[model samples]
Structures are given as structure tokens and as C-alpha cells.
Target: MDEQQCWEIIEAARDDAGQAWDHLDERLEHTLTRHLVKLSPPEVARFAEFFRALQHRVNREDLFMAAFLIHHGCDDDGFGDFRAGLVGLGRDWYTRALQDPDVLAEHPAVRARADISALMLAGFRYAPERALEELTGEEYDGYYDSGEPVRLDDPPPQAAPVPRRLEKLAALFPRQQAYLRELYPQLTE
Candidate 1:
């Protein structure tokens, strides 16, 4: 998809918020996947590199807040956190952020807004599978398109504790709990 088309889809999804998947008639997922497939190898590599770097910066506190915000569908504030945390972090900081996200958390505002939990959740949701598909030039057999019973591999153990805040939110919102379980099955265990 062209930049304009991409932005249009993104805007539409943002407008729909948590229900973007259903509101966009499911075209959003396919469009995104198609766009990913269109990217060159180097571009895809860079994308994967960025996620790995960002993942490295995330701390336990950040993860807790992220999961809380995402489970509650707090997109506006979440977007703010992402922009403020990453916008000015140059290429070098990207490398450093992976080692010590503390630098990104230096500004209290940035720390307050950047939801590393949500970022981590999103990364787990899409990045790895996309990267694998992009690099291998083969589609995963998982039913991403059909929304059927997609096969899931065993999830890695979670090192961090599931915060009480997130536990309460999950209890209140079963859908979010289900979503979280889909991404991090260990949460259920």
C-alpha cells in the first residue's frame, strides 16, 4: 500500500479504537500484512531490529502500566507515551534503549506516558510472526486472515509479576483477559 493508503487505514483504525478490527471489515489486517510483504528485505530487517531494541528498554514497571492501559483500551494516552518516549531518541539511543530503557525513562513525563507493557504486548501480538513471514517469504499456517483457530506455540515464561492493577482490570474485562492470554498464555497459567 502507498503511504496515503497506509495512513488512511491507520486513521480509520484509530477512529474505531479497540474495535478497529471489527469496524474496518477485517481489511485492516490484510492490508497491513500485504504492506509488510511489500517491504524489501532490508526494510523488514530494520523493522524487526527496532522492535528488538525497544523490547530491551522495557522494565517491570513499564510493563505493568502498559498492560493496564492496553487492557483498558487507553489509546490516546498510550499514543502520547509512545511519541514522547521515542520521537527524540536517535539511532544511538535505540541501541542504548535496548540495554537501558532508563534513559528513555529519564523524563518523568516520558516515563509516565510510555507504556512499555502495551508496546511489549503489541510486539508479541504481531512482530515476531510478521518478521518470520517476511524473512522466509512464506505465510504462517496460522489463521490470521480467517480468525479461525490459529495454532499457537508454547509461550515463553514471563519473568515479571502480573501487577495487581492488571489483575483487577482483567477481572473486570474478560475480553482483555482473553486477549492477554492469547498473547501471553503464561498469564493464564
Candidate 2:
């Protein structure tokens, strides 16, 4: 979809509430994903750069928390805040998320789960050093074999702090917390 069409969908969703909002949000995400898949290599590179730049400005923890909320059906105020954050960042973030939903996997909550983490890592062209640090040297090698220069024996990087908002959201949604714990026992610790 063109930029104008994308914005129009976003604008419509911004004012919508209840089921309408959910439908619109899904529609917006679908369109953005479609657009992302159709981009040329140069366009993909530009989008990736734009995504990285925007990532620096936003609370990535919050974004991941928002993704969890959206994923688990917590679509009230939290969804609104998450949607606003995406809209504020413009279409690039949407495109980036479509390109690599694992971008959200940077959050510790996401990393705690092996299945989710694996899926996220698969989206990445380059192995995320922090994510793989916990793995054995053999495990890392098995996961990614680009043959590029990388040190597998180094210590895993320190984890990023989980944002207060993410914590609060988790606390507020006990079901989500339970779901996470069920899938990833480490999250409860």
C-alpha cells in the first residue's frame, strides 16, 4: 500500500473503539506486512535503517510488552498506548515489525521462552549475540552458520532491564502472566 493509504488506515483505527478498533488494527498490520514483503532490497535496507533509528528513540521494552498484550488479547488502554506509540513512530516501525517481529524479542520477557526466542532469532539474518550468549558453543554454531566472523566462546552479554511499564502491564494482566509462565517458567523468577 502507498504511504497515504497506510496513514488513512491508521487514522481510521486511531478513532475506532472496541471490535472496530481491533479490526482496523489487524487491517493496518496486514497492509504494512504486505508492503514490507513487496519492497526491493534497497527499500528493505532503508526500512531497516529507519527501524534501527526509531528503536533508539522508543522504549523497546514497552513495545515488546505491547506486542505481548496484543498477542494475548489485552486490547483496552494498553493496546491504545501501543498503537499510539507505533503511529508516533510512523510507518517505518510497522514495516520493521512486519520485517522482523523478533525485534520485540529483545525484551527479556520474550527471551525467557525458548520457542518464542527461536522464532524471533530465525527472523534475524545475523545472530543476536545477547540471545545466543547463553547457549553452548556448539548450540550457537548449530543455530547460525553464516560463516561470518563471530566469537562463540565469549560470555553472554548482560540482559537489558525490563521496563517498569512492562512489569506493570504483566502484573495487571494475571492471565497473560500465567500464560507467559506456562510457556516460559523463567518469567516467574
Candidate 3:
């Protein structure tokens, strides 16, 4: 690990207070962007918006946010933080719709989702929902079409579900409970 990562892990793994200060400078996400590839101009702006929305739900401390980001984005592809990009785009949609509920109220399909959580594990795969063949309705028409295949994987891929993703991450790292208790007293209860 690099100097910054080690220091960050040490500090970030501390109590919530430490994490807040450490991350306050955006250091919490420095390593986050380090591994991130880049996305299109639009995708980058979109994900920034999504990450902003998730900032509110960042309770339960780092694990929740980490898990969410890792689960959603954290892909080492050229466009880093793939999930963040999509969710950001989705958040923009949500905010726009909130200001004008009737815009999508007439649309049956777009009515039933929040946070772009539903967008993961799909062909859109957070590339650009509006650009994707499946999800976009009126939005797809006359957009700059980038027919790039976002993956180097086999033609058909099956990604894990959200719950399974959480379990999987916990299992892989398997941080000790006692350590967690030391870091977060509330975890013991």
C-alpha cells in the first residue's frame, strides 16, 4: 500500500469523528479516485451529482458509504466509479422529477425507482441509462451514440445482487468484530 492509503486506512478506520475530519479534505475519497478510471465528460458530471446525493445517507459511518460505493462503482474500468456515475445521473433525474413530478408521472416505467439502485447489474451497467437501448424512452433520440462495449468480459455477464454484494465484501475483508467495537462502540450493541 502507498503511504497515503496506509495513513488513510489507519485514520479512516478510526472512530467516526476521525473519519469525518480525515475525509473532510476529501481525503476519504482520494484513494477512491485513485483507482477510478475516467468516464465521458457527461458521465463524470453525472456521477458527481450522484455521489453528492449519497453523501446524505453516509450514516453508519464509513462502511455504509464504502460498501455502497464499492458495490455500485469501484470498478477498475476506464471509467472509474462506474456505479457512482450512474447513480449521479439518476439523482439528477430524481431531482429534476421532484421539481416537476408530472414530467415522469405520466410515464409508467420510470415511476418506480429511486437512487438509481435499480440500474446496477444491467446492460446499461451505468454506462448511460438514457443512452442504453433498454431504459431510455424519449431520452435516447438523437444523442451522441458511443457504441463502445464497456466490458472486456465474455459477452454475457452476471453480476451479484446488492445484499449478496455486502455479504461478499464483508466476507472477503472480514474485519474483526473486536476491532470494529474498538472503533465503533455502537457496533457492540
TM-score top scorer:
1
- Look at candidate 2 and give me any clashing residue pairs: none
> What RMSD, rounded to one decimal, does every model reach?
13.1, 14.3, 18.8
Candidate 2 residue 144 C-alpha distance from true site, Å? 22
TM-score of 2: 0.31
Per-residue error at 54 for model 1, in Å?
Answer: 2.8
**Per-residue lDDT for 121-142 in model 2, tens only?**
1122211221233332233432
TM-scores, all candidates, are 0.32, 0.31, 0.22
RMSD of 3: 18.8
lDDT of 3 by residue, 1-189 (tens): 222332233233222223222122233233333322233434433433333333222222323323333233222331223233232234444333233322332222223323233223222223233222222233443234233323211121222222222333333334533333454444333
Please give the ranking of all candidate structures by TM-score, highest first, separated by commas: 1, 2, 3
Q: After superposition, how far is residue 92 of candidate 1 from its true place, in Å?
A: 21
Candidate 1 residue runs with Cα over 4 Å from true position: 1-29, 65-124, 131-189
The per-residue C-alpha lDDT of model 3 at residue 16 equals 25
Question: What's the lDDT for residue 44 in model 2?
Answer: 35
